[model samples]
Every structure is written in C-alpha cells, then in structure tokens.
Target: MRYISTRGDAPALGFEDVLLTGLATDGGLYVPESLPHFSIEEIRSWRGLSYSELAFNVMHPFVDDAIPADDFRAMLEETYKEFAHQAVAPLVQLDTNEWVMELFRGPTLAFKDFALQLLGRLLDYVLEKRKQHVVIMGATSGDTGSAAIEGCRRCEHVDIFILHPHERVSEVQRRQMTTVLGDNIHNIAVRGNFDDCQRMVKESFGDQSFLGGKTQLAAVNSINWARIMAQIVYYFHASLALGGPDRSLAFSVPTGNFGDIFAGYLAKKMGLPISQLVIATNRNDILHRFMSGNRYEQHQLEHTLSPSMDIMVSSNFERLLFDLHGRDGALVKDLLERAQQGPVSIEDYRWRHARKLFDSDAVDDKLTCDTIREVFERNEYLLDPHTAIGVRAARNCRRDPAVPMVTLGTAHPAKFPDAIAESGLSIKPELPVHMADLFEREERCSVLENDLSAVQSFIADHWKHA
Candidate 1:
C-alpha cells in the first residue's frame, strides 16, 4: 500500500517514507491511496485474536513490505506489552447498550499511547534500517506530549521535542511531559494556546531549513500517517469485542485534533460494521459545529476543564474533506484557504454527505462537570472531563438504541482532578501504581515565547542528534 497526500501534489510514498514524513511538502496530510477491505468471512475470522494479533491484521496491509512480518509482529508485541491492561484497549459497560472503551492503560495514561507507542517503535525500526537520525517535533494539548516522550525516549536515532501551551494544561498533564528524564527528550512550555503551538509545529514542518539543511524533521502528532495507522487498530478491536460485522457498532470519540475519530472514519471505510461516528468536543467546538450544523467556523479558543479538546482548529478534518470532495485536492486547498480568512461552508452535497455518518455535540465546562457527576451517580464510574463529553454526546446523539455505543475513555480520571472535584464530589483520584510518585518527580523544561523563530532556534541549538 502506498500513501498519497490530501493535496494530491506530493509524490505517492510507501509506509516507511510516510512514517518519517510528518506533513506533505504541499502542506497536506497523508492518506492511503486506497484502503484495504476485509470481507465478512475475513472479518469473522478475526474473532478471537488478541489486541496485538488483531492490530497486526488490521495494520499489516498498510505496513506492506515496509518491515518483515516476523520483525513487525515482534515490534507490535513489545510495544503493547508496556500497557497496564491485558485487554490493551478494554471495554467497560456503563449501560445495557452503552460502554466505555478504556484507552488509558498505557504508559502515559491516555489514548495517544495506543498510537505513539507503536509509532516510536516503527520509527526506530525504519531509521535503524536506513542508518539515519531525525528530529521529531510535536505540539500537544496534554496527553500526546507525555505519550510521545514515553514512547520515543528509548529511541537512539530520535531526538523528540514536544511543546505544550504554558499554564493551559492540567497539572498531571504538565507533569507527565516534564517529569520524564531522558537525554533525547525535550519539553517546552510555550506562552500561547494549543492552536498556537500546533501552528508552530505545522509551520516548522513546512520549512525545516532551520535544521541546517541536513537533519530531517519528523512528526509524532496525528498529522503523521503512522499515528493514524496505529490508531485504526483499536477501532477494530473495540468493534469486534462488541460482536461487530454480525451487528453494527457505534463509536463516540472524545475528539480534539480529529485524528481519533478520523480513525473511526477509516475503519468504516475498511468495512467495519459501524452504524455511526460521533464527534465529541468541549468548548472549542469547531469540529462539532461543522459536523452538526455545517458551520465550519473558528471561534476564540477557550481554556476549559478538558484541556485536550480545547482546540479551535481541527487539523485532521481536511482528510475527511478530501474524501467528501471526491478527492479533488484543488477544492480542498481552496476550501482551507478560504477557511483561514473566515468561516467557510462546503457545497450542499458535501455537507449532507458528511452529516450522514457523523453526528456531533459541543459540551461546555458546566455540562462536562454535570455529565461526570451524573455518570458517577448512575454507574459509579469515574470519567475524565474529555470522556465525560464523549458519554454525553453518545447519549444525546445516538442514532439507534439497539446498536452498542462505545465511548472512548480517552484519559484516566486522575489526570484531571480539578474537573472531577468541581463536579461536587470530594473524591480525589489517585495516580496509577506506575505514576504513583508523579508529583514528587523533578521537571525539566524551557519556557519559550510563542514565536516560530525562537522555537526553531531552540530545536536547532539543542538537537543532540544533529
């Protein structure tokens, strides 16, 4: 399988190149030229496979000929072995037809670990083969920073730098990135919002001449195809666990960057029996507004209890628009260019096509807190602010009651104690055993202004790999 950029200008690339190339030269995200499909018999044959086994089956087609099957299998096995749960992404029933897929069982206690853990390994394998070193730059709202650090800290050929909005992320979220001590890991607290940090990362990817024209730049963000490829596995795992293929399943994803739910879109493309995909957002509801009401407009970014979903710009939405526009890159390019100036609307048919499969709702901080308290009261289940939005959306926008609704538990409740406490519950969630001493750990990070040149200089100055 080969990957093509959404803009349709970049040359078609194999999986290895797509893994290393974060953003296309034309400022587009990479998607497979064609998705692999599984027949009903093939889907049914995967009933009892373990998560790793199922992941290998789901993703192997994309990784075609990039690595030997045995080596790739071993890499996947070693990657997921670090997760805290045996069912790597397990399901917890909240109601008879409602369930939560617990995705924080990995090293960083967030859904990002599901993809970044494997991405780090994949990068190491490919870089080792090519005898090359690259700088991995990413912007995180909360979870991706720590998860990327944890995943790539062990990689010798990678110098990983993650920037997060200063004073914007939760304490646990901040500590998770700053606490990890590694020679190759660098964290920067930028004086801006998540969108600012994300814009800087994207700008840097567009122009890497700051690396002295030798060192290559990579990405661990959802922009990278590898991250999206790794994420698609869990959708299959979750759907099959709920008796998919025989019966359609519905997924409610706590979306921020749009990567997680886009994986669900790809799963539906690859023949998963998905009835609908729900887009759950906090106050930064650009995606929700677009999907729900066909108003693709950006508003002022809000600092919410769910810091991860506090994004005004949804990056991966372009990939869906690419397909919705029938793969017309020029149209997507025009639409995005128009969007930058102000709110832009797609053609009537395009809007209607997207609405068929996607339903969305925007949950503010008050509603988020209320949902958390309600879920705790009803099921005695604790939910993080992000997952609480997903649960609320799942209930409010579900298309059918008979179909099993799986809301992605994006992060552990302990990660957002302030939000949980604000729900009027006195209970304080504790860190898991592995992160028991998270508060006690010393942090190392640089406080930088949200300027592109300054951040680029820091990467150029401190790049040990270079």
Candidate 2:
C-alpha cells in the first residue's frame, strides 16, 4: 500500500517508508493512498481471534510488503505479551449498552502502549537491516513519554529523546518518564506548557541540520503512520467483543492531539459499523469548538485536572480538513495558515457533512471530578480525570440509548492519584504491584528553557554519534 501526504505535495511512499518518514517533507501527516476495505463477511470471520491474531489480520495489509508474515507475527506476539492483562485491551460493562474499554493494561499503563511498543520494534528491524542510526524526538503532555521510552529503551539503533512540560504534568506522570535511566533514553523538562514542548519538536523536525547529518530523525508521536496503524487494532478488538459487524457501536474518545480519535475514524472508514464518534475534551477545547461551531481557532491553553488533554493546537486536525475540503492540499494549506492568526472556517456544506458523524463537548474541572465521583458511586469503579471526561461526553452527547456507548479509558487511575483525591474519595488509589515503588525511584532529568535552540542543541550534544 502506498501512503500520500495530507498536504498532497510530498511524494507517495510505501508502508515502510511512511513508518520512518513520519511528517512529510511538506509538513503534513501521511495517510494511506487507499484504505483497504473489509467486507461484512470478512470482518465477521474475525470474531474470536486472539488480540495478537486480530492485530495481524487487521494490520497485515498495511505492512505486508515491509516484513514477512511469520516475522511480523512474531514481533506482534512479543509486543503484546508485555501487557499486564491477557486480553491486552479489555472491556468492562458499566450499564446496559454502556461500557469502558480499559486500555491502560499495558506496560506504561496508558493506551499509547498499544502502538508505541510495536513501533519501537518495527523501527529497530528496518534500521538494523539498513545499518542506519536514527534519532526519535517526541513531546508528550503525560503518557506518551513514558510509554515511548519503555517501548524503545532496548532499541539497538536509535537514540530517543522525550520532552514534557516541567511541573505541568502530574507527579506520577513526570516520575514515570524520568526514573527510566539510560544513556540512550533522555528526558527533558521544558519550562512551558505542552504546546510549547510540542512546537519545539515540530520545529526541530522541520529543520534537522542541527543533527549534522550523522543521523536521520524519526517520530514516536501519533504523526507517525505506524502508531496510528497499531491503534486501529484495539478499536476493532473492542467492537468485536461487544458484538460488532452486525451491530453498530459508538465511541467517545478523550483526545488531545486528535490521534486516538483519528484512529477510530479510520476504523469506521474500514467498514466497522460505528454509529457515532464523540470528541471528548478537557478545558483546552479547540476540537470541541470546531465540531460544535464551524470556527477552527486557537486560544489560550489551560491547565486542568486532566493534564493529558491540555493542548491548544490539535496538530492532526489538518488531516481531517484535507478530506473535508475534498483533498485539496492548497486549500488545507491556506486554511491552516489562516487559523494561526485568527478563526478559520470551511464551506457550510462541508461543515454540515462532518457534523453528521461527529459530535463534541468540552468538560471542565468540576465536571471532571464530579463525573469521577459519580461513576465510582454508581458502579464502584474509579476513573482517571481523562477517562472521566470521556464518560461524561459519552453520556451528554449520546444520541441513542440502545447503541453500545464505549468510552476509551485512556489511563490507569493509579497514575493520577491527585485527581482521585480531588474527587472527594477517601480511599487511596494504589499503584500497580510492579510500580508500587514508583515514588521512591531516583529520577534523572534535565530542565531546559522552552527555547527551541537550547532544546535542539541539547539533543545534538548528547546524541550518540553514528
């Protein structure tokens, strides 16, 4: 399968090239040139397959020519075996036709492990074959940093750097990334919000002359096609478990960067019978505003209880605009540029078409904490702030009561104890057995100014020369 840039200016590439190339040369995300559609019978046949087996079947079309069948199967098996749960991504029912897809059962205790664990291995395999060394640069609000480091720490051919906002993320989230000490794994605490850190990474990728030609730059962010490919599997997994193919399901995703919900969008395009997709957000709600009104604009970033969704700029939204504008790259380019300075909008017909499948709502801090308390009181289940927002949106924006509404549980509650405490619950949420000593672990990290030059220079000086 060939992949083309959303901006339509970059050259088309095969799956392996797309995996490593990440953002296209024209500063656009890559999407498949043609999505492989599965018929109802084809999807129905995959009802009882294991998670790894289902993953292989769903993702094979994208990576078939990149890796041999048996080798790819072996890597997938290895990737998921590290998950703490046997089901990998499991579903827990809350009420009739209402459920939560628990995605934090993996190594790093977040939904990101579903993709990053495999992405690290795929990059290693291709780099080793070509005898090339590369550098991975990513910025995270909370979970992605730890998940990426855990997945790629053992990689043989890459030096990975992850940046998170200093004193902005929860203590547990910061410790998870900082405690994992390795020469190849470097963590930076940027003195700004998540958007500042994300911008630095994007700017560095735009111009990589700082690396001095010794290494190629790679991405672990959702902008990488491979990460999105792995995420598509769980959407299929959850749907099949809840009786899919014949019955339509609805998903409410707590999204910040728009990658996770974008994966759900792709699943629907590939023939999953999804009735509705809800865009759940925290106070920083550019996506929510766009879905409710036609205006797509940026505002001041906010810090809420759910730090993971604290983003002003939704980077992947451009991918959706590329489609909404009938795949006109020039139009997408102009729209995005205009959005930077002020509010930008699309044609009324295009906006109305999007409103058909998508609905959205922005949850504030009080509602987030209240939802967490309410869910725990109703079902004896605790929710992290992010997942609480997802649950709230699923209920508030749900159009039908009969359809199964499954909110994507983004992270483990143990990872965000402050939120649990703020919910007025007396019980303390303990960490998992393996991470029980997380607070006691010695952390090593460097604090850097939010300046792009300082951040880029740090990576250049510390990167292991090829």
Cα TM-score per model: 0.99, 0.99
- Candidate 2 at residue 66, lDDT? 86
What RMSD value applies to candidate 1?
0.8
The collision pairs in model 2 are none
Model 2 root mean square deviation, Cα atoms: 0.9
Per-candidate local distance difference test = 0.92, 0.92
lDDT of 1 by residue, 363-454 (tens): 99999999999999998899999999999999999999999999999999999999999999889999999899999999999999989999
Instruction: At residue 353, give the lDDT of candidate 2.
Output: 91
Model 2, total clashes: 0
Candidate 2 residue spans exceeding 4 A from truth: none
For each predicted model, how many residue pairs clash, with residues at least 3 apart or on different chains? 0, 0
Residue clash pairs of candidate 1:
none
> 184 in model 1: Cα distance from truth in Å?
1.0
**Candidate 1 — which residues are off by over 4 angstroms?**
none
